[model samples]
Target: MSEMLEVKEQETLSETVPVFGYELIREVLLPDILGEETPKILYWAGKNLARKYPLKSASEIITFFKQAGWGDLRVVKESKNEQILELSSEMIVNRMKTNGKTTFQLEAGFLAQQYEGQKQVITEAFEHPKKRSAKVQFTIKWDMKDFA
Candidate 1:
């Protein structure tokens, strides 16, 4: 009975939301305002977070993205039963600059850097470090068509 209580406690703790900020930055706020570079870092962060939580399929990942308010998840090119998912967020163009050299920047340099600092499980840079503004691309490949 005590073991059950302990498990319950852990579950409760994990579901608790903080009053400070979100663990995963939403997809909508990444691209335009954050710059072209943010999509990759956000995508990587989303992937890592999904793995940590371990969703059964890509659709589940989409749902997770939606629930997080990242943005509208869309399948751009679907071949056979597999498709590529593209996530985008609205960006405030004027807010894209940072004062630091490389590390101070977010989205491309800053976003990737911060996501890297999380030590979650992401290590891939979506774009070249020097160029923080680029296309936002994330590919989701799977065979489950009706997955949610």
Candidate 2:
């Protein structure tokens, strides 16, 4: 009975396997393959993802980011034409701490595309990475005249 219980427990534990070596693909391999266009490609891919998800509100967007393992997304500020968001995560910190000049254009572009779809406008996003703080701030802006 004791051996059977141990086997069951081990099986349960083994069901929850953790993924490893993602950084090698995301940080190194993709960049090496994409080179100068890595940022652009990532940004567009993020936008494409947003289009598929099509969230309704800012809170939903934040939740999506968390669920997608992107990071903690918070609203720093909001205005008639712009919204500022701060993103931070373990991966983000590790990248910033080790790789001085890394970019999170994917997150920025995702926000931009989500906002654009929601507001029915042409939106653009810019990323500002703070290495010391190990966070990325995204500023998403839209023009009222450019309707989608």
Alpha-carbon error at 85 in model 2, in Å? 0.4
What would the TM-score be for candidate 2 when compared with the true structure? 0.85
Q: What is the lDDT of candidate 1?
A: 0.38
For candidate 1, lDDT tens digit of each residue in 1-148? 1344345446665574542233223324344466766645555555454344444444644554444444444555656433344545432111223212122112233222222333333333332222254124443233333333
TM-score of each: 0.35, 0.85
Q: Summarize candidate 2's per-residue lDDT along 17-72 as a digit string, tens digits.
A: 23236567778888999998999999998899788777788888887786566789
How accurate locally is residue 43 in candidate 2, as Cα lDDT from 0 to 100? Answer: 97
What are the lDDT figures for the candidates, one per model?
0.38, 0.82
Best by TM-score: 2
**Clash pairs (backbone) in predicted model 1:** 27-70, 28-70, 28-89, 32-91, 33-91, 33-92, 105-110, 106-110, 106-111, 107-111
Each candidate's clash count = 10, 0
Off by over 4 Å in 2: 1-20
